[model samples]
Target chain A: MQVSVKYFASLRELMGEASSVIDIEENISVSELWQSILESKKVVFDNVMMAVNMEYVKSEHQLKSGDEVAFFPPVTGG
Target chain B: MLIEIRKEAFNAYAEMQYYLDELDIDGQYGATASFVGTMRDFNEDKNITSLTLEYYPGMTEKHLETIVNGAIEKWNLLDVLILHRVGKIKIAEDIVLVATWSAHRKDAFESCRVIMEQLKSGAPFWKKEETTTGVKWVEKNTPGF
Candidate 1:
């Protein structure tokens, strides 16, 4: 399976890219995918917010093919 | 319920008037509550010149719709008009407008606050300010409470 991942705000700056499409094994959780990305990028973040397919999701949520996953810093809008 | 993400500046008063005129919900609303947030020229002791706002396009719309829907249900609102700006914004420019209408003042006022607070803390929008020293991404928003 494959998913499109996106980084926003400060996370985008840290990740050094806006978005990417990556192949992933089946039954992969959101946290696992994030860990893999962090490991590969050699970056560390204490926390982040995640969304799957445009909706907020728990880290334990499983990924699916064609899912648009987003990770971003805390929001600051009014 | 109306939710919009704008890439350019907007006048809140004119927008509210136009929205009311278009919807024509005249007799139903006895009270109209609104909150407009503007960019400040200074932040954290830095003189800010402008700001660059960013958001997740599809997800931002969806999240705003959800916020509006929740407010409508909780307050039994007659209507809601929300407009948020993205892209570059100058100092003292209007960044967001949230207006709520209801038969009574309490619901209108409370729901408007709720919506704004929720948006401040939860919405996908992010702001990077052009400060005197350098540009910086806002780490967090003020507490909603």
Candidate 2:
């Protein structure tokens, strides 16, 4: 399956890109996705939070094709 | 009616005037209160050059709406607006705009307090300061829910 992912703040800078489309296996969990990305890239969004399809979802939330996955660093805005 | 997140901003006078105009409507709201948060050049003795504020796009918007709506539910307010700025903001820049309209001073005051307090804690925004020495994240002595 394929999905879109977004990176923000430190995560974006670390990833060296804002977003990208990638291919993954079916029913991939958030943590599993993190491992896969690490294997292919030099990005560290380790402590960051993620959301799937616009909702603040936990990493364990199962992902499907075409979902827009976002990763955010520890929040600071007010 | 405008809840914007911008990279640059002017003084909060315009939003104040805008709210005043709305609240001044006859028999609409008895009182209105406003506050403008500015970026101080010095945060606890740091000669900050600039501030880079980062926010979670979808979550930040949702959190702001939920907070403002919560305030409205608790207070008898007529209207409200919240504006927050992001990106590289210089010292002395206008950081935030908050406004409230209510039936009386009490509601206006309460709503303003709640909104401001919630922003400090709940809004999913982080600040990194570029100071004379180097860049550092602003520490939160008190965390919020």
DockQ of each: 0.91, 0.44
Residues A1-78, candidate 1: write the lDDT tens digits: 889999999999999999999999999999999999999999998769999999999999999999999999998876
> What is the lDDT, from 0 to 100, of the residue B4 in candidate 1?
93
Candidate models: Cα lDDT each: 0.92, 0.79
lDDT per residue as tens, model 2, B24-141: 4568778878878888788778899989888877778887887888987899988888888998898788888888888799999888878978877667788889999998877552
Q: Is the docking of candidate 2 incorrect, acceptable, medium or high quality?
A: acceptable
Q: Pick the candidate with the highest lDDT.
A: 1
Model 1: number of backbone collisions: 0
Clashes of each: 0, 4
DockQ of 1: 0.91
The candidate 2 chain A region of ten consecutive residues with least summed lDDT is: A42-51
Using DockQ, give the best candidate's number: 1
**Model 1 quality (TM-score):** 0.97
Query: What TM-score quantifies how close candidate 2 is to the native fold?
Result: 0.81
